[model samples]
Each structure stands twice: as structure tokens, then as C-alpha cells.
Target: QDNRISIWSVGDLGNVGLNGEYQGEPQLLCDIRHNGDVMDMQFLDQERIVVASSTGDVTIFRHHQNNQTLSANQRWEKAHYHVDRQASCGGAACTGVICNNPEIVTVGEDGRINFFRADQKGAMRTIDNADSSTLHAVTFLRTTEILTVNSIGQLKIWDLRQQRNEPSQILSLTGDRVPLHCVDRHPNQQHIVATGGQDGMLSIWDIRQGTMPVSLLNAHEAEMWEVHFHPSDPDHLFTCSEDGSLWHWDTSTNVSEKPSFLHQGGRSSTYFSHNTINQSVVSAWLSNDPTKDRMEITNLIPNQTLSVNSLDVLGPCLVYGTDAEAIYVNRHLFA
Candidate 1:
């Protein structure tokens, strides 16, 4: 719980064996003290990093590659806060932050969304009341559009080009509002989005279609913490949960090609209508025929039961952090 941002260089993982374990310790690059509890962080670029805090402040830090030290660059103080009868209360936590090179977007418990440029000290645009509840996470659907998940299981889409502060569209879960915790968009298909909720269910949505999600897959046993699509291979998905499990979902196999007798005459219909979707271009996530829609799931951590808080997958590497104050790296993900 010590609010600190530490950087480490995981030396060449090429030596990691087929077992996927790396016995060597990561080399400490630098450690910097943060203003408040670090809520989220992202690399602004190779030389800079952006951090969001519980104090509702967002700061950019410069990492000196040669000296291996960090220096504060730009700071946006009190970017989010609760207003009561014209008085601003203690700053609300900036829960999520995303970077799009020069542009930075932050969402907070105060239900505010702030947009900033790396060179500017002030927010370029502010959506004062983006949501009535806390915004948990955000991701860019397109260069000009962003999607945000809130405390009440609602996903709202905002268009940056619009002068209006209101969201362009809203989508939500069917029943009791299970707070959504994390979200990630498909690397290859911008229209496909995945969200994880407090109920541990994984919902896949085609933002171009109806308001409801296309598929709701039963996943973790406890609150699902994070979900990510492999940066290079969109067919591979990763999810970590409070139940202390990290799962790898593989949809690479051609399960859709297998003929199914479930459809007697016409095209097969599954959880969602795929009649219009071209099989060759359609994502396996939108597979028709429930009988043939099979996804192989592998639990990465089966023994430990402490919460797996966050995870990221890039190429053949998979790294995750846990509530037990440990970070695990699996280098041979594809093997």
C-alpha cells in the first residue's frame, strides 16, 4: 500500500525454459514516490509515464534512460472532485487513466472525465457529470471515441468530436447492476469489446450492434479484476480474478467450421444472430451454434488462492500481479 512507482527491467526472458518459469529476479531500474495512492499508470511514451492518484491528481514523469532516474514533468492537480453547493470537497479518486500518445483521458469516482494533452497543464475538455456512479475503467474504441464502464454495470460511449457533454449511447447488463471492474477492446476488431464485472462474468459486446452484449461467458468464481486481449494475437484472451486465478482463453481453433446438426435447414443461430456476419472475417468470439462454440480455457494459477489483481499479455509473454505482493512472469506462453 506504499504509494510508489517502481520500474524494473526483466532481463532477456529468452532463457526461460519450456515450463514458462523464470528464476532470475528482475533488475530494479528506479523507484519514485507518488503523491497519493497510485490508482493507475500508463506509458505516455518511451521517455515519459503518466500516473493517476486517489487525490484526483494526474502527473507525468520523465524517465532518464541513461541515469535510470525519474523526474516529475507535468501535474494536473484536483482534476476530479465532488462539488457540494458550490464547494469542492476532498478530491475523488482518479480510478482509471488511458493514454493515446499525446492525449490522456482520466475517469474518477466523482463521475467526471478529463482530457489532457501531454504539453498542456490544464484539461482541454471536461465532462463534468459523465456518470452518476463511479467510472471504473475506460478504453478507446476508435481514435475519436472512448467507452467507459461504471459502478452500475453501464457502458457509455463518448465521442470526442461532439461539443455535447452527454454520452452518445448507453449499454447495460440485464438484471441487478453488477459493477463492472475492467474492460478491453479487441486488437484486430475495433467493434468487439470485452468487459469483466463484479459477478465474475465476462461479457463480449459488438458495439456496432444492439445495446446488450453478444455473449455472457461464465468465468471467475469471484470478482473479475482485469481482462485483456493479446496484443498480437486477438484470438488469445487473458483474465484475472479475486478468486486468485488467471485464465487464458484460446479461440484459435476452427470450431466454427465444424458442421452441426442443430441447424436442420437454414443457418445456425446461437446466443447472437450471426446470419449477417461473414465467417471468414467474423471473430471466433461471435461464433454461432452453441454446440460448436468451444473455447479452450487454461488456468494459469491453480494452487494459489490469493487474488490475481492484474494481468497483461504481449506476444508470448504473460505477466501478472497478485494480492500476495508477488509478480509472476510466464515467458513461454505460446509453448
Candidate 2:
């Protein structure tokens, strides 16, 4: 038997026998540690995994193939250095992006965007610059600009070309000061951006105009968790919330009726959770090819003592890690 992560077939534990799926001696993929809870993760190509943890550390791991299974080759602990005193990651949390090369872009709990690049020998570069705020979400628009949202319901666009003190553009919500939870740019139109906030609102803005949005909608009843633009079209988009709802919006149509459900043929596209421990659900894009719709959800894996902090998906397999010194690369649920 291989001393790797074991795989068990679905059923009661009593049903696990010698004929089960655990005998192949699967490889021990990797072990990722976090000081606090992990908030998000991004994979760079097929070999690296980037993680954003609640302890304000953004780390990267290299994947190696051994015995026909994947395992971690190397790791970078404390990938993003925090400016504030080392404390539990609170307020607007940090996030990572692999925009152009192997640069790790993370928004700090202190409202700064830090960049770390991979050198020729794969060592991460020292953080070059940091922008301010309790930055909730940070992402790239082209290679030179990044869009970010923060606790004060303000959207700021940073021009990396200018080594300056502040962002090139700043936009705030018109009516209320609801902490923005997520921000994204339209996949087709680089000038357009969308934002979701604690006020259960979604708004679209064009940088050509001032900070106020061109289109706004009360997208959800509860706090919005995430929002994304369609990979192929700027007209369509998706959003999810704590209220257990997923909405599909078409920005090209009547702005008053922008948000619609993603259910197919009058069926729900999501499952409802009864308890709070498993209530927080996170979704990530496995592929953004625009030719295919591939996505995956990561959460606590039952029966494993460690808490699942982050996860990734490739084809029909789910790769995840836990708080108790464990990482998993397992098969996904398929029809």
C-alpha cells in the first residue's frame, strides 16, 4: 500500500473493503499550511497552486508527478508580506491573481495590492509596491491595470504604469456605503467593470465616466458573496450570495430586469445547506476558455479531521487542502 492520501468510495465507512478504490497507492499530493482560514486559491497552469489565507499569507506550491499521480514539488510560505502588525486576517481579506507571467498579485487586509513575481530560478520576487485599503477583492484589467473594491463601497482602478501614491480612478456607490464584497471586469469590454456589495446590490461602470456606475441593480436580498462577468460576452454575467441564490444577468437588455436565475428548465442549479458550519460555499472557474463551462465548488470534506481551507478542479477531479496538515487531489462528482 502506498503511504499517500487514501480515496474511499461513497457509502458508509463499514462498506469500505479490500475491493474498494483505496488500494492503488495514490501519491501524497502536498501539504499546505495556513495560520488562519484560507479564503481563496488560484492555479497557475498545471504545475503551481496559489493560495490566499485568512492569516494574510499568499503562498504558491509546485505540483510534481510521481507514480502517475500529482504531488507538491516546492512551496513559498508567507508569499505576500503584510504591512500591518501580524494579526488574524480580518476586514476585507486578500486574494491572488496570475495575470501575465508568474506574478502573484494579492490585496492586503490593510488595503494594499502587492505584486510578487517568479524569478528565472522560480524564486518569488520581493513585493515591489503596495496600494492602500482593506482591499476585499483585486483583479487585473489587461496587464497594466487592476480593479479593486473595499470595505467602504468604493471602487478604485490602479494604473501600474505610474509609480504613484494613489489609483488613477476612484468610484464610490451613489446611495449607500455598503462594503463591497467582490469586483470584476467585463470579459469583452476592458473598460467596463461590475461590483457587488453588502447592500445586496450590483452595479456596472465604465472607466470613461466618473466613479458613479452606469447601471445599478438590487441584485440580491442578502449580502453578495461573489460576482463574475461571462468569459465570452460582456452582456451576460453571474452572481452568488449568502441567501442561497445564483443569478444570471443580461446587461444588454432592460436594466430594470437585469438579474435572473441560472436554473435550467425550472430546476435549481444549487443546493441548500441546513447548518452554518457548511453554509459558506465558494465557487471558482476551473477553466475560462469560453468554449466550455467548467466550474467547481470547494468546502469541508467530511470524514477528514482537517478543515478544508481551499480547493481546485481539473476535469473531473477535485484538489483541495485542509487546516490539519493535509492536501487532496480527488475525483469530482459526475453524472
Candidate 3:
């Protein structure tokens, strides 16, 4: 249908094209992007797209130019640079970035999440800090807190309530044998958050606690890549791994004396990415709750064959970048 939006992916070698169910074949919209490799591309609402490169530069583009042959609207050189060195780094280096309402936070191999305020002035600043251990992922908990996870299995929670300061809480996955690969917080409740580590572990925590995790759920059979919680449900979570699988779990189901492994068998996959979810599915109560139990049922979309290097979800749609120099837009085409 013409109502559906078109999807596009640009390769590291500068091959940019579109992917979708259009006519007899997919279409190539244009080849305007000129980076040696597109390290990370994020859509801000529907009008603008931001692309980060391995050269430690950032560029902003308007989604659709009036002329189809035209490329992105405006380009900037060395948008994100190390305050100390003022140089560029190579590909596959930027680990995490989050576009908070008015600002954007990005972290690269330098172990710092540089902050940029989206303004007419277009100024950049380092508003906060995290543990300097290979900042793998960074996200905002509500608007005031920033949750950052490093390669060392440590989760740093920075309180933006305090202006331009370090984190107020530092939680480490020290007891677990694996290093955390990704971390995500509950969209509705700032108190709850989840982490996925190298050992295929999914540990959930309450932000108030000093160090103890609320629960540890082994949701995958291999090294876990990412963990995502349903946008509206605090108890419904998803995990993906190199094991070529995506697992969904309802934390409420663990209330019974029965072992969690029986429920752990629920797995789905289309391509391997960081996290997955459904928008309509809201809160789900634990099975044994006195009130009626609510279950958020999400169908697992199939994944592409290339190793998924990065994955992100917005509402019902998911965008993932793979090691094969391709990105995929996996929509619920049938369901």
C-alpha cells in the first residue's frame, strides 16, 4: 500500500538503497550518503535522520528531499570529536547513543558519551560522565537519568538531576561470569531495568538498590547481544543472542514455585539484533496474581542471516545493522 513508508539502508562501502515490498522488485532511492561506512543512523521523528561515522563525525539529514535525485539536506564535518585530542577514529567504534527529547548522547571507543543539544545554535557539550570501561551502551531512564553499560559488565546510572556530574549509582554484574553487552530500562517505570551479558544472562534490577539485582533470568542458550523491555510493560522483556534466537519473558510468570526454565523455552527470531517488542502489548501481571493476569503476546519476526551488529526498536518496527555491511527494516508484513 502507498500508506506504508519505504525503508532504506546504506552500506559501509557507500552502497545506499531501499528495501520493501514494492512492485516486482525493491527500489534504490538514491546514493547521496558519502561516508566510507555508515556506523550508526538514527531517525529523529520522521523528518530528520542522523548518521554517525567511524571518523568521529556526525551529520544530520532531512528524510525526504523534494528532488528524488538530491542527497541529504545538510552535512557537518567532525561533528563529534574528542575534547582532549580533536581527532577521528575508524569504523565499528561507536558503541552507544541515545536521543533524549532535546539532546543526544553518544559514546565511542574513547569511553565517553559526548552530549549534543539539538538547537539552532547547534552546540556540543559533555554534560555527564560514566565509568571509563569501554562504554558499550547508553540510554536515558525517563528524562533525568542516564543508564550506561560498559564491556566490563558494569551498569552506570547517571543522575542528570545534578548538572554535568558523574553517576549517582554504579551497579556491576560482578557475580555473573559474563560481561554485559547491552542494557535497557523500563519505559514506564524508571525503577526497573534489565541487562544482557556475554554469558547469556538477563539480570533485572530495581534502581533503588545499592548493588543487588532484583532477579537474574537466563533467557538465552548463548552469548546474549541485547535486552529490551516492552514500551508499556515493566514485566515483559525480550533478549537476543549470537545463538541465533530471540527470547521473550514475562517476569510475572516466575511467581510460582515452579522453575523458570519451563517458561524460558519461549524463543523467537527473524534476525539477530539488540532488542524487539510490540506496541499494543502493555502491562502483564504475574500468573499467580490475585487480580486477572495480563499477558503481552508478541510474535517474533524472522531475522536476516548476517550477524546483527546493532539493533534498535521503535514501536512495532525494528531497525538493525549487520556485520555484512547491510541494514534491515523488519516490519510485521503479514501480521
Best-fitting candidate, measured by lDDT?
Answer: 1
Flag the better candidate by TM-score, 1 or 2. Answer: 1
lDDT of 3 by residue, 1-335 (tens): 01112345322322323433122233566445445455555665565666666555555666564654423554444543445434444333555667764577776655666666654344465542345566767778877678887777777777766765677788776554356778787775566677887777767766664465655655555677777775654455666666655555654443333222111125421111123243222222211221233333332434534445556654444555455664555443222
Query: Model 3 segments beyond 4 Å from truth?
Result: 1-28, 34-37, 68-92, 120-124, 127-129, 176-178, 232-236, 250-306, 314-335
Better of 2 and 3 by TM-score: 3
Sorted on lDDT, highest at the top, how do the candidates line up? 1, 3, 2
Q: What TM-score should be assigned to candidate 2?
A: 0.60
Each prediction's TM-score against the native? Answer: 0.91, 0.60, 0.67
User: What is the overall TM-score of model 1 with all chains considered together?
Assistant: 0.91
Query: TM-score of predicted model 3?
Result: 0.67
Extract clashing residue pairs from model 3. Answer: 252-286, 270-302, 270-303, 271-302, 271-303, 271-304
How many clashes (backbone N, Cα, C below 3 Å) per candidate?
A: 0, 5, 6
What are the lDDT figures for the candidates, one per model? 0.84, 0.53, 0.55
Candidate 2 regions with alpha-carbon error over 4 angstroms = 1-35, 65-98, 120-132, 251-335
lDDT of 2 at 142: 79
